[model samples]
Target: MFCNQCEQTAKGTGCTKVGVCGKQPDVAALQDLLIYALQGLSLVTAQARAKGVSDAAVNRFINEGVFSTLTNVDFDPARFQVLINEAVAHREAIKLRAGLTVDNPAATFTPAATLEGLVAQGEQHGISEALEAHEDLRSLKQILIYGLKGVAAYADHAAILGHEDESVYEFVQRALVKSLENLGVDELVGLCMECGQINLKAMELLDGGNTGTYGHPVPTEVPLGPKKGKAILVSGHDLKDLGLLLEQTAGKGISIYTHGEMLPCHGYPELKKHPHFHGHYGTAWQNQQKEFSEFPGAILMTTNCIQKPVESYKGNIFTTGLVGWPGVTHVGKDFSTVIEKALEMPGFAADEDKGSVLTGFARNAVLGVADKVIAAVKSGDIRHFFLVAGCDGAKPGRNYYTEFVEKVPQDCIVLTLACGKFRFFDKKLGDIGGIPRLLDIGQCNDAYSAIQIASALAGAFGCGVNDLPLSMVLSWYEQKAVAILLTLLSLGIKGIRLGPTLPAFITPTVLNVLVENFDIKPLTTPDEDLKAILG
Candidate 1:
């Protein structure tokens, strides 16, 4: 069970025995098998689409099955088995519907009846075996596969809010089928770029879904402190789940606090309107073990970025949607059980006066003040902008981001999104004139908003985004960050500084291509990088 699909893979190589994300070997094998099943399903689905026969359920399942194999999304072997079985069923149905017969191993694959048999079969299809191609080709395939995982995640989120795009689904199936081919470097790279382009559309759909349903995020100050009441912490990036939970727990006296990526939800007008909606708790997902143990309430994880729950808070933690652990209680759309759990537990006994952080500086809120921002930049009051954003992990070099933000000059504005901002989110960076020096542009899911902000700013300045005075210093932890990076690169955004570590799956030859084509570089010390960017 070797896996190197994430930043924190064991020893920066591969997770051989157990996953760093607490995924057991059996669960790992099951996830591998699930992906194998999806490859087969994708084969059949691609054929069906060509024959003018497509199933919405199968298309949706393709995204779900792929998303489940992402880091920390689902860790239950039982769940993976269910998904595998469902994938086979979908494949068989699609084959029958399309009246086609394909002889590819993936197309004719069959799952074992028992869980042990499934795991054993999965072991044969692990990443090491599946990607046994040339070094460079394997790297490109890894990038493509990981990028697909990220696209599936965003697409799934958008579909949940009633936003659907057939092209996104079509591109997913086409790419999956292409992965099984003996494509060359140029062709595979073209597919990777296509993945980025499709991801842009998926993200646009997600942005519309979120802003259309909850209204554009407005500049709002959210308290980081506690409220005295029955409490429930909502984490991850699902706004709909949080909204539903807010509605159910509103009159029941439960104070809902946003955690991790959910912290940005406070800026959404529809969500913040709930009077009982409390402030944020905890930092990033990495610190959840310590933070969740300290929180005196029930916890709900809506999506990815879930860690192995500690014993202290394991019983109180409930998972919904795709997030799952072996023994933790899983709830559906109705969160009555989560509400009851919060009622049963002792919430915050007293209120605390911890200061608040400003959020909801998404595209709409930021663009709303475009006139002022443009004036400030024209007046030379603002020097440069730094889009310091990405995922945050517990790796050692993550302190680079913390120190980098602290050392950012007073004349520049720091635009941040995702959990990476947790490194220096609480800092009082003040503002350049009326604009805050630190602008929180919502969650990782809100990368589309950040891209829009940059594009709008570039348009106002009559220059390309690269010609603008902005540098992207990104830290990646999982596949979603990989997807976002591809999106940036596909847009011809260059000279980006990515660290704390490079992906192990990328060989030196492949890394040289990125360096030559895109000028992508590994992050150095904060002081050196700061001097280079500002100078």
Candidate 2:
């Protein structure tokens, strides 16, 4: 299988048999085939563009197809097989129209209908095709590829909200074509930075789409406990699917609770105003196996981070928006079946009182109180601002994030996003001048919010973003975090403390480039790192 696109890769190297995330060898092979097919599709699309023809449909399909290959996102080989066939069909149609004769294997390759044949085909196109024994070129190529996966995920989300950026689509095609070229280490490294720049624009489009559609998120307290009666738990990062379920179940008895990345939905005023929208149900994605089983009602996973389900809860798991399990139900815009299942089961029995945590400090929420925050900083009431964010994982060293947040000075503010905040999200960090010391931003996509807030602060303080008293202590588990890190590096942001461990795919030579140019370092003890940042 040879998948190492995530933090949980086996032995910090590669997953060659079964994926640590429970992806089978066949499924991994299908994912590789699907990626290979997309590169072919990219070739066709790039040629089509040269002829003054661009297919938004092909662009959107490319985004969704690449996103499905992300670790822990989709494990359904059948789905990938279908996507592969579709990619071939799309490329053939586009090539016929463009009247171009490209000799790329990805463009003309034929797949066998049998699983073994598909696997054989994929073996030829796996990431090892980069074959740069030179190490640096290989590493940069891998980084660029992974960064595109993150871009696809974010761009897919924006597409759901009816937002499309043509320039970003062109960049995706051009970069994918770069993979076919034997580019030098320097050129591939430049391509990686360009991916970061494009990812920033992609994220900005997503932020606009989300806020424009859902309204700017507002600070609100989300219950840590469940509500009584029939319920449906919504997970993943798709707010559109969650909103549809909420609407369909509103007048009915079904109550909806956000899980994992969906936890931030409560801060959106449009969603929070729903009477049946109960609070967040769990900590983060990693804990879902146990939490999903314990929930009494039906579950709907809208996007990625779905683990292999246990038998006890397998039947209750329904997927939508490209997420699938072998036997789980995959639904469409209509969520009637999910609601019926929720009604058939026991939900909560009775409401529990587990207190609450504040969330929704997205860009608008934070910038709304910009004056107060600026005054606090000027008066030294808030001495430092730490952007502690990124994806969370089950690794042992992750405790450093919790411990670091635990020891932050009372006067500092911790602005966090993504599931990583779950480490200290429930902790009471108090507030400075009515601004909560611990600000919960939205999902990982909302890293744009953190960046915007920092830039605004820098402008107000008459200094560069690096000159501000802020440090980004990040923990990454998947490709989206990689893309975000690239964006930060592209901005020339420095001294980022990243952990629990570095990506297995990053070669030492590439690591040296990152360290020398970005001042990136691994996380240290809470006390020691805090002293270094605050000193």
Candidate 3:
């Protein structure tokens, strides 16, 4: 189970035993196999496109396959195996549909005599195949795989909001087929950059979907304490789920508290309008085990970053969407079970603080105030736009984020979200034109906001996204972050300093692909990274 597509990979290398995220060997292997089958699908789809087959079906296959492998998305091996089988079946069906066998991962579309070969192939020893590749080649392959996983996640979110891009899907299928062949460093590097470029479109689509559906995010205050009455802690990056929960529980004496990535949802106009919506409850995703214990409410997870659930709060943890575990309640599109679970739990204790967290600073809102921001930048009141975006982890060195934010030149504006913002979100980072420098832009998905803000600034100043005075200093802990990084790369954003650690799983081949193509360098000291960025 050698997996390392996340910042929290075991010891900053690979998770060889049980995943640090609690993914067992079987699940990891199935994820790998699922990806392998998806490659088959990608290969066939690419071939079909040559013969006039649409990449749309193949795109959905890639999106689901990659998304199924994201961190904390599916720890249930049984479910993942089902997905793998389905992907293999899809490959066969694609061959049948296209009137072609696509017998192997490397083969083009050709009708199969039986589904037996593909199914038998999937059930075959995963490790024997895993061990056949050169370590570097395997690593580069995984990098492409992880990048697609990231892109798929972004695409999936957009799909949920009804903004689908056919080209993003085609790019994913093309990227998957490219990873299957043994390519040289230069070729692999080009493919990696292309992956990144497509991700930018994926992120934009999702950003448009989200802001279109929920309105822009404003700079709002989120309460850090607990709440009173029947309550549920909602985690992850999905605002629609929180909105649904808030709607079902409206006037029902049930309070919904934002947890982890959901903490930024407090700033959205649609989500914040809920009177029953309570303040944030815990610190970050890593602190859930401590925070959930003895917490007098149920918890609803709309997405990833869910580590192993402890016994005390296991019953309290219910999941919807793609987030699933072995024993947790799986709420489908219908969130009634969440509502029922909320009703069953003791209502939140006597903790009532009616307040709002300022947000709505997405592209539309930020661009609306473009002149003010530009004036601040020109006057030196806003010296820089510091995009402190990405994942948050339990790693000790993550303290660097807090310290970095603390030490950044006061005139800089801090745009942050996802769990990473927990480090400095509570701190006072001064202001730029009466707006707090520490701006929370939704969740990890909202990294799109930072990109939008940068693009707007570039347009305002007549430059590219990378040419702005904005520096992206990211901290990743999961695969969704992988997708976001790919998006940044797809946009040609350069010189991103990623830390507290690089994925242990990325081989030298994959690392070189990223470094050479994007000039992506790891973080040194906050002082050194600051010097580099400021320079």
lDDT of candidate 2 over 203-246, digit per residue (tens): 99998888888889998998998778888999999988988888
Global fold similarity of model 1 (TM-score): 0.99
Candidate 1 regions with alpha-carbon error over 4 angstroms: none
Candidate 1 residues 1-535, lDDT tens each? 8899998999999999999988899998998888888888999988888889999989999999999999989999899999999999989988888998978998888899999999999998887788746989999999999999999999999999999999999999889888888889999999998898899999999999999999999988999899998999999899999999988887898899999999989999999999999899999999999999999999999989899999999999999999999899999999999999999999999999899999999999899998999899899899899989999998799999999999999999999999999999999999887899999998887889989998999999999999998899999999988888889989999999999999998899989999999999899999999999987
TM-scores of the candidates are 0.99, 0.99, 0.90
How much lDDT does candidate 2 score?
Answer: 0.89
Q: In model 2, where do residues sit more than 4 Å from their true spots?
A: none
Worst 10 residues of 2 by lDDT: 126-135
lDDT of 3 by residue, 1-535 (tens): 5667777777777777878878877677667667676777788877777788774655665686788788878887567656666666777677777777565634432322343443344434243364326777666656667777888888887887888988888888888777766677667656767887777788888888877887777766676666667888888777778788888888888878887777767767887888888688777888889988767878888867787889998988888888889998888767777778778888656765653344546666677778988999888888887888777878779998988998899888888767888887777666777777877766777777777778778988998877787888899887768767766776778889898888776766667867997899988898988877777
Question: What global local distance difference test value does model 1 have?
Answer: 0.92
Please estimate how well model 3 matches the true structure, expressed as its whole-model Cα lDDT. 0.75
Which pairs clash inside model 2?
Answer: none
lDDT of each: 0.92, 0.89, 0.75
Model 2: lDDT of residue 35: 85
